[model samples]
Target: MRGAILPADSDQAVLAGRLDLGEGPTPVLIRGGMVEDVSAAAPTVSDLLERDDPAAVRGRPLFAAAELADRGPLLAPVDLQAIKACGVTFAVSAIERVIEEAARGDMDAAAAVRGRLEARVGAGIRSVVPGTPEAASLKAALVEDGMWSQYLEVAIGPDAEVFTKTAVLASVGWGAEIGVRSDSGWNNPEPEIVLVTNSKGRIAGAALGNDVNLRDFEGRSALLLGKAKDNNASCAIGPFIRLFDDGFTMDDVRAAELDLVIEGPEGYRLDGHSSMVQISRDPEELVRQARSEHHYPDGFALFLGTLFAPVQDRDEPGRGFTHKVGDVVTISTPKLGTLVNRVTTSDRAPAWTFGIGALMRNLAERGLLDIGGGAGDGHD
Candidate 1:
């Protein structure tokens, strides 16, 4: 993990090439390390935001810590596509890659990959613990974990940033947050993940919602953290994933302003703008520290947050937008000035359907409670 020592003063910003381990976005902005933002200015990434029309608000709501710090408040409306336009190269190294291997069903190989990703995200590559066959199998299924469109519920709230990073995280566009999932039909309900957002097109805070996810629908069994991880944390929730280190505490997150709202037509809406009130685990630290604690199974809890903004149908098209996923469901919006979200395929069959609030109630019945904004096993 030998990196160039960047004093607290020198200033420059640009993306890195190849797999700059111990040097990519995660470490550069490590809760403890002063950022060495070598990334270029916004112009490069902004120019590629496909839909630049003054009217299109549909684009990706993405920006690393450096990008957020450099850019002004993320209060403007943006769609998913526009956000993903900024293509930067960050390799999936060591333990990160290892986990992907395990998630793919290769226990032995996955154990190897775990050794690597865990090392990279954690303190060092040399300390990764071996993965068990069971852990590896779980990883395999976990890798293919796609957000369910027909089975999701919305915990309408003021903040939850990850919703904004749909494309990057769950590989889907938005969620059943507002009811209309990317592949939902009137008959079937979509309760992929419980989400929260602001009515305006901004996410400067973390949106919290517990998991009502069911492993076997109808309150039979609850989806554990592994099953719900992809559903829950699929992106970076910020303009506010603060860098905390020695002496820093939840009090700082409490001080940060997180604007959230839910607006569409005139009458139906919900909004809550909260100052984070508290944030204790700095993700960067958790990830890195995991490297140190890899030996202990489930010993470390890693969280990756982001703002959520899905494509919704509102008078004409709402400026807010998202990158559609499914091949069957197509949504129209006036915010981005066009059909901002939709399924790309020609399939029209109602393969899956979901309901509102039912998913949450069912999960609770099965012992799956939304532990804050994440899933629960009743542990810490």
Candidate 2:
């Protein structure tokens, strides 16, 4: 399972992630298939990424990557970093959001609304670049046709919708249970590429993430976004963060393609795909918008919105897909590896008790809080 979750090119990809060795989250590096405890280099991932070259930093040898399944459970690969996400960045997702809105969160109504909405404006939304005159014109046309939507506004408007996803230390890692709201009748996993950045907003690395969402909550009212998104163990990020190096860079991210598979307990199977190339807004552009007015002192992980939105009927024909308990969701891309998690209700999932305060206390007790050195200071 450890090897399955690692990047296909694990030997070449420079990776950084966290592991719980009984006490607390420990920063580690996976280079040349070996996992090295980098606590001395940096106590937290936020601090590790602050370095000019995180891949070059070295530390005590822990175990081989293959031995990860026997080690402590892997963490979300981030600590002290803000979790943020962009929405409506892909045409298909944008259209889906509009359908969610138009249907007013009713699962039965969504199918009908989806067909009408797609027939009306899908091509126009797909062709125009966001924040362009063409997009504005499309917006005007939609409005005239009584089809203007807030989702469409963000989809084509100059401003991207960047919002907080979850609290620090709240996201689960690979093989953990990802949660959906207990009462949510309509929800699905959003498989996306999460950009890891420093305080300066420089994208340092990328990881696979499942932005677990409740369509009904958000569809009923955009005001319910907080309730729809932030739930216990709702966000899933990791196995590891693939740090950008000579062999891997932002260009690779731009061309990256993601594949999603959800295997239900009742033998239900759903497969989806998302290509970064089809995104309406560029990854760098989304980052710029995220950093426009706010500041993430501890850095942040930005979820690049997905192109895949499940519209397949799970049970009844008109009712669309929704997660059932015990569903095993796998989001994978060759370069980033796989993020596999089982489905559970938010209330039933393990509670998130380890927070920023807990992390500080743990680091202090470990005598790792006093280390002070920049990028090149600690290395082999």
Candidate 3:
């Protein structure tokens, strides 16, 4: 006997199965100041997160868009122990990084490093094996057993003490704004499609992330990445989480489109779009690398990297443009909606002002190379 097929009117059923709605819950939103499950279920997003099987609540009814408030403030969708990010996983981003690294004070040294970076990233694009010449060369650039590198800067390390800005910036229905430091040498919102993993590194769902960074700090010296990435109020993610399920296929993900739109304080707009095909690595690969030596008992967030960049004109090089305070950046995609944030400068005191001058003077008095430039000695 042949099996019966779901009728054409079963598109809702298809969505339910695809998003794991029929069992646990549809994507939940804190709409109209009330917790509402986008799925037809009564379990709130918080309730679903606490369940052993969050998707079990999907059998509940779907929420009507009309009944909920048209718009309101949105949360980060889920609470994760750590927010991690991958780098050099896109062709355009790889090239942009090489170019920026090449411009780091010395043109000749930067040129040599740029060639090596290009060759490494190119080989990685072709294959992921460890023993290959490209793999070995790339591995050598990074220390700590290739877990960290010049390109792969960890925005949020496994340390829980560093979590910041878990809530997303809300702007009605269009998008959101992110804060950028005005004094930062280079700042840009990298549009990334992120993966949400469980405590054990299992894929749970996907969300959109804006991996905001200070490119100049990163370029100036590879050792200063912490200063470049771990600035206060520098990271954000939101819109909603799309739970992984049998129906949510890779084809569905690759077919979706993503755009990174920016608006400066003067209202000048720049359009940037990313191609999923340009994604160099998959979520599994990113997760494996992120969990290399550390244990994420509370799970973690992983940014899959960016594939789009601003267009370059004659006056500007490939990525000479940088985001300044008051600029707004939005990551828009059909699956994840629009995640937005505005750039703003931090008001904290300078990092070098905490008795550092006296310490430097003390070291100089001891004849320890006068590293602090006292009396214009400039000796090390």
Best by TM-score: 2
Q: What is the TM-score of each candidate against the true structure?
A: 0.25, 0.96, 0.63
Worst 10 residues of 3 by lDDT: 1-10
RMSD of each: 22.3, 3.1, 15.9
Instruction: Please list the C-alpha lDDT of all candidates, in the order they appear.
Output: 0.23, 0.91, 0.51
Question: What is the TM-score of candidate 2?
Answer: 0.96
Of 1 and 3, the candidate ahead on TM-score is: 3
> Model 2 over residues 1-380: C-alpha lDDT tens digits?
33387888989998999998777788999988798999987899999999888988988998899888666457999888899999989999999999999999999999889889999998999999999999999999999999999999999999999889999889999889999999999999999999999887889999999999999999999999999999999999998999998888999999999999999999999999999999998999899889887767778899999999999999999898999999999999999999989999999999889888888888899898965543334321
| Candidate 2 segments exceeding 4 Å error | 1-3, 371-380
Give the Å shift of residue 346 in candidate 2: 0.5
Worst-scoring 10-residue span by lDDT in model 2: 371-380
Total clashing pairs in model 1:
78
For residue 207, what is the lDDT in candidate 2?
A: 98
Ranking by TM-score: 2, 3, 1
